[model samples]
Target chain A: MPVKSLKKYVGVPRDVVANFHGKQVVYVSWDQHLLFAAPLMLCLPPQTTFRELVDGPLAALIAPDPDAAAVDWSTVQWLKANQPWVPDFDRSLADNGIVHKDQLRLSTPGLNSLRPAA
Target chain B: MDMKTEKKTLNLKERYRLLTRDLGWEPSYRSADEVFPYVKYEGIKVHDWGKWEDPFRLTMDAYWKYQAEKERKFYAIVDAHAQNNGHLNITDARYLSALKLFLQAISPGEYAAGKGFARVGREFPGVGTQVACQMQALDEIRHAQTQIHALSNYNKYYDGFHAFADARDRIWYTSVARSFFDDAMSAGPFEFMIAIGFSFEYVLTNLLFVPFMSGAAYNGDMATVTFGFSAQSDEARHMTLGLECIKFMLEQDPDNLPIVQGWIDKWFWRGFRVLGLVSTMMDYMLPKRVMSWREAWEIYGVENGGALFRDLARYGVRPPKGWDDAEKAIDHMSHQIMLGLYQWSFGTSFHSWIPSDDDMEWLAKKYPTTFDKYYRPRWNHIKKLAAAGTPFKNFGLAKLCQCCQLPVVFTEPDDPTLLCNRETVYEGEKYHFCSDGCQQVFENEPEKYVQAWLPMPQLFQMFDGDVAAWMDWVSLRDGHDNGDYDGSRDQQNFQQWRGLATSNQ
Candidate 1:
């Protein structure tokens, strides 16, 4: 039924914009790490930090389901590809020097079972 | 009695004028509006029909003679190639997938162009312009015929080359091309010129033809290369016609400038979206890569197209909108599209394979910034999964963009990782686009595009939501032709054919 439900939403996650040459692009994985969604295109104005994005656009875009409990902000780990999870919400995406279109998997404190053991 | 004999002979220019412009007949009872009603609706202003230029001075007599000679020479090569088993000379059997794609996706587009140009040729008010359109109509038809003839030999040895016109109408991926031409055909004559003639022929033809022909040359498919060369000469005149049409429109009235610019913006993005297929072929499908898609885009799109816009700046024309987004997309479009095609090969007419390590290294060298860091890892993972006996293929249908009909695979402009899902509600129904450009195209002419023949919805309605039934309805034989290349019928056949040849040798 879920797969059929996906068919109703006529699009797949195939378009990956890979042109981040000579710029700092941060990759943050979202949605329980089950789906390989495209990264957020950061065209925010200057002086806008990653913290602002998480609080404002990202939170609004990926708010927890009403049926599910709210996700704790501080307990979420920002893990890079093949790297251990790091809990640092204060650092900006620009400060992380993330390459454009790179994969950044999100890990919550108790949601380790949702992700493959890494 | 000796009579003074005198005869008058017209020069080339004078003969061209007499043959083209002087041949128009005025209606005795009917008004011009009644005769040429379709030209006035698109809001394109043309004050002087005399201003339309016939730069090639092409007449029907000369056209027939020249084209007949080229056809003669072209078919000779096709015959030779077929007799010599030229299919075996290709770099690898896998390379024919590119040719198969060209046949199914692009060759039918030529036939559509023929029909569109014929309509425009009859409807336009200017005689000279009509003659030019008529010639191009003939050229487009010839292009379709020659391509089909050139590739018909491969049908005996391959699976995808058969039932191309059927596939173009029914296949999900083929809709990317069909919908584009359908859009152009349904517009007014002037907009048709801008959409197909200018945006497609002049702006993006090089990126489409050059790499494919060169790829053909590198792979020893002489017949295909010959077809490309023959079609290209006609393309030169078509390019001139495209340029002439735009300039004539802009020079006629200042009122036409904004309209022309809007069409350019709309059609350029549309044309670029169609070229997504060609981009994948140039980068991934060719066994011996002729040039990188990025390199081809820079030369054909950025340098030449940028210069053309700069030259036109004197007439208040700038480059098309979304130029920046297109430039950025060049780095990742081919890589992204190949992954999609490889994963979905089971549903397609052709086979797909993972790039070898050597191919990946070459891609890394070509795309120094992104390939090594971003794409290579994903590919490595896919290859590992495939080795572990779990290859990726989408079992469910994909949602296609309402405008381009391509699978919504494009990411956001500024960020490469995020999917750019843009939608607008029209007539209480929401329409989705892959990017802002496509969304803008839809919003501009919602009435025209809202009627787009999207394959997925049609499949659901017509085939009871079964992909296998849909494939059967479309004439694509499953397992026999479509799937991974390693153990498919085509690959196995090629191995057998080559083995026999080796034994005889």
Candidate 2:
């Protein structure tokens, strides 16, 4: 039998998010529409890439099935068919002193580093 | 008399009980140092290891059986969930960013500790720490594996999960965790307990694990939270071990009082600095956030830790050396760090704008000190952008502490605006970090954290050359974030599971 589309307000309860056992997920809102996916939790604009969104924390949470057959990329022709928008780094990070990877960042020395001058 | 001595044998259980309780012998040595040399140099003295009590009365068989049972229960849950395509909400797999960070930055550190303890156990054979170390070694391995297994279930559904374990071997920021653990493992057994167990687990873990699991639960993820809490129970045991070890050291000798107090002082501050990330996450990460870092600090740090220390003071143990500094920083650090992360979080982890008016109202009530005074103006801008139908763009590079990896948001000792900034020049180049604790770390052994190969550099390196090859490599390694739970094997299984469930209903 074919899987039906999740019904509006009536299908699955929103709190079912807590019931999930294996994967980490977040609800991202695009205007009024809500999209559910695993890994990234941000409410991204329509253009973020699959690559940029998958971070280290999210990557470590995914468990693989022991008996699943090997994956074939040829089946994923749909991703190539649809061009998704990639996310750009936001500007506010700098105000907090966070440097982009391309930029040179400075850290303050620790207190332990300060000795009664040698 | 001969007839009475004739045939009596104790059973295995009785023998273990008697042996563990009775095996200890009083030292017949030139000095206590000849028997336990390592305990003295670190400035910690233990008058009695015998005074330490294991609350569970966990003899060896009970330990093995209970531990095995726990593993069995956890794996059973893992299997059932996996069989059902238990990954929930399409967004569920995307949140792997947190797991990625844990595996790469924190998981290997746990394993490293196991190795470290194995060595420490050998060095300090008589101290009860060897047993504690053994338990921790096993617990750390369990933590690493359980974390990997829980997350591995999502590998089929997500990207980036695979690269993280490898990333631990390479990342610079990761060195913060690695170096912190190495420092503990290399220190005397007493300091190791203070640093990793007492300071890290007891005082700081609630800040890290509670918020993290709550975030997982709030985000509609169950498996991650389960694993996190499961590992955390073991953390609680470790905490007990730590407290016991410290008290034992302090009571062991008259001279150990000052020494043990100093170790407590040093390790507490060291572990506290590392919790900056946790502070940010607790305060900012979850959509449905829990107790603010301010409240958490007040309750756990001030109330619990402060009170605990007060009780210990009755025994001549003083509060940790830098307790005041920690208290002063707690009021502001999490907010400053979160404000920074909110700006740069785009394309990393799950990015979201700063708090809404409702959220700010909650924060103001929770953190009356700095929220209104310093943080409100900043949130107003973010709020304005959200209202204007513009999600705030990424913020700039927040200065990370070279040692602790926290952003340089610490206020100058007593002042907030004048950033509590410090730096050191090792071998002619300047290295900056946030606090005296971290600075001491870098200065003590500049060679360690300096050797770290940051992940951002590696990612950029991959991106700069061989575009197709890099994309392909990173996609397999990082897990592509393509929208739509459309075509992965996990998604397909999810569909099948959904189909079956609904049909049954």
Top-scoring candidate (lDDT):
1
For model 1, give the TM-score of chain B: 0.97
C-alpha TM-scores of all predictions: 0.82, 0.65
- TM-score, A chain, model 2: 0.18
Residue B317 of model 1 has an lDDT of: 95
- lDDT string for model 1 (B1-505, tens) is 9987776876767778778755577887999888888876667788998898879998677788899999999999999999999878788888989998999899999999999999999998888899999999999999999999999999999888888888888888899999999989977889999999999999989989988999999988999999998998899999999999999999999999988999999999999999999999988889899999999998999999999999899999999997998988888788878877876787789888889999999899989976775577667766776787876554434556788888767767776655565666665454667789999888776666767777765654465457789889788999866888878888888888888887874
Interface RMSD (Cα, Å) for model 1: 17.0
Error of 2 at B120 (Å): 2.2
**Chain B TM-score of every predicted model:** 0.97, 0.76
Quality class of the docking in candidate 1, CAPRI style: incorrect
Cα error, candidate 1, residue B78 (Å): 0.5
Interface RMSD of 2: 23.5
